[model samples]
Target: ASYSVRRVVKKSKRRYGRKLESQFQHGGSRSLWQGLRTITDYRTPSSRMVNADASLADELNARFKAADNHANGASGTNSVHAERAGEVNTFTTSEHDVRRAFKRVNTR
Candidate 1:
């Protein structure tokens, strides 16, 4: 299994090193290195685990990308707090009129 991971990292580092190489590189702290090793093990590939890891990674990546797309959209950027901020602009109805109308309708 050791060689299984070495081979995968070696190959992937060549193409997409920026995203994953630092994960395998030596860390500043011993504990951090140990944590990376554990993750490396879970991500380590085998004939069996390779397909499963790829499937799960693809699904998770798709979800993140979809969320990213939405966040970058104009509609998604207006959060609930921001939407309610300028909503009090005086319109045809006043603050009290809308509530009174609702009460009149409900009373009937």
Candidate 2:
């Protein structure tokens, strides 16, 4: 039946997973790397690998900025207003004042 077939497939997958775990535990460094690559599906970069430098980063930033500008151009709702913070008058307190305040506390 289809139910029995599904159970058999699940059991086989579990057995394969256990086999991979055992390989990770008992295998050498090479096998460990192989197992990791297998699990992650890691692939070597092509010859046209991009060097990560400031110029490439700036280009990406500019592209993203242009895209954001284009997307938000139609909707003129991105204005942010800055508010001035209330000024506080400074008051000087001495160590004697701090000690006297601490002494009034009950030490229970």
How close to the true structure is residue 36 of candidate 1, measured as C-alpha lDDT? 58
Error of 2 at 101 (Å): 48
For all the candidates, what are their Cα RMSDs to the real structure? 23.7, 17.3
Please, what are the lDDT tens digits per residue for candidate 2 over residues 2-98? 9999999999989878877777788665886787788789887887646678988799987776676577673433332112234455899999999
Shift of residue 31 alpha carbon in model 2, Å: 2.7
lDDT of 2: 0.74
Alpha-carbon shift of residue 17 in model 1 (angstroms): 48
- Model 1 CA deviation exceeding 4 Å by range: 1-52, 74-108
TM-score of every candidate: 0.21, 0.34
Model 2 residue runs over 4 Å out of place are: 49-108
- Candidate 1 residue lDDT tens string, 1-108: 999999998988685544345555654366555665675664545476544767798899878767765776734444644767977766587869888888888542
Give the least accurate 10-residue stretch of model 1, judged by summed lDDT.
19-28
